[model samples]
Target: MIALIQRVSSATVTIENETVGAIGPGLLVLLGVEKGDDQAKADKLVRKVLAYRVFADADDKMNLNVSQAGGSLLVVSQFTLAADTNTGLRPSFSNGASHQDAEHWYQYFVQAARAQGMTTETGRFAADMQVSLVNDGPVTFWLQV
Candidate 1:
């Protein structure tokens, strides 16, 4: 499993002109599941994302987790994160998990986030989604497990 974590002042996910999920002062998470990824791996990634000290504290040091800073979370499924382009111009998604399997893992990841008591919202799995965000610090990080 991989996650492209972006800190955002606010974020929203829309599909077919309808807003599906939204969050404020939190992280915008783009998740990808590989063929061998499982609940344990997804769980580990979620723990890392939640506990990562990416937020600044009162001293202006980046030493606080989202929970300490009282932020929300927006989790979105993005299969492209697992794409490989070493061969040519086109990216190959062969490393990505199948759609059905990916969806299952995605749901489990979101559930894990929710279990942490954070306000977690998610984009529709496998849906054509347009995501909007006002990036906070324009901060982003990638994680794999």
Candidate 2:
């Protein structure tokens, strides 16, 4: 499992002009499920996303985790994150999981995050989503498990 997390002041996902998911003062999580990824990987990645310290603290240091900063999470399924673009102009999806498998793990990850008492929102799986965000500090991280 892979996650590209961005600290954001606000974020939203729209499907056909309908706002499907939105958040304020949160992390926008672009989640990807690769071949061979499973529930354990999803669980580990979710734990890391919640606990990874990327928020600024009282001393103006990036030492606070999302939960500690009282931030919500907007998780979006993005298989493109697994694209193998290292070799050619066109990216390959050879490393990405099948749609069915990816969706299963994606949902499991969201449920696990919510189960951990985090404020979580999500984009519809397989939907043509338009995601918008005000990236605070433009801070981003790529995490994998």
Candidate 3:
């Protein structure tokens, strides 16, 4: 499993011109699930995401975490994260899980986040979505498990 976490001041996801998920002052996590990922991988991702100290502290240092910042989360499934472009031409998607398998892990990832007390919102599985956000400090980080 992999995730690209972007700290955002605000964010939203729209499908067919309907706003489906939104959040303010939170993190926008673009998630990717690879072959063989299971419930334990989902658990590890949630725990790490929750504990990651990306938010700023009172001293203006990058010391606070999402839990401490009282922030929310907007999760979007992005299989393309696993795209391997090292070859001469087309990127290899073999590293990514099958669509059905990926969706399963994505849902589990969301459930794990909710279990960790995050006010998490998610994009519709396998839906065409338009995501928009104003990144806080333009901060971005990656996680893998």
lDDT per residue (tens digit) for residues 1-145 in model 1: 9999999999999999999999989899999999999878988998999999889999999999999999989999999999987899999999999989999999999999999897899999989999999998989999999
| Number of the top-ranking candidate, with TM-score as the measure | 2
> TM-scores of all models?
0.98, 0.98, 0.97
Which pairs, if any, clash in model 1?
none
Clashes of each: 0, 0, 0
Error of 3 at 68 (Å): 0.6
* Model 1 / residue 133 / CA error / Å: 0.6
Alpha carbon deviation, residue 53, candidate 1 (Å): 0.9
Q: Which stretches of candidate 3 lie over 4 Å from their true place?
A: none
| Candidate 1: residue 96 Cα off by (Å) | 0.4
lDDT top scorer: 2
Model-by-model lDDT, in order? 0.94, 0.96, 0.93
Q: Candidate 2, residue 34: CA error in Å?
A: 0.2
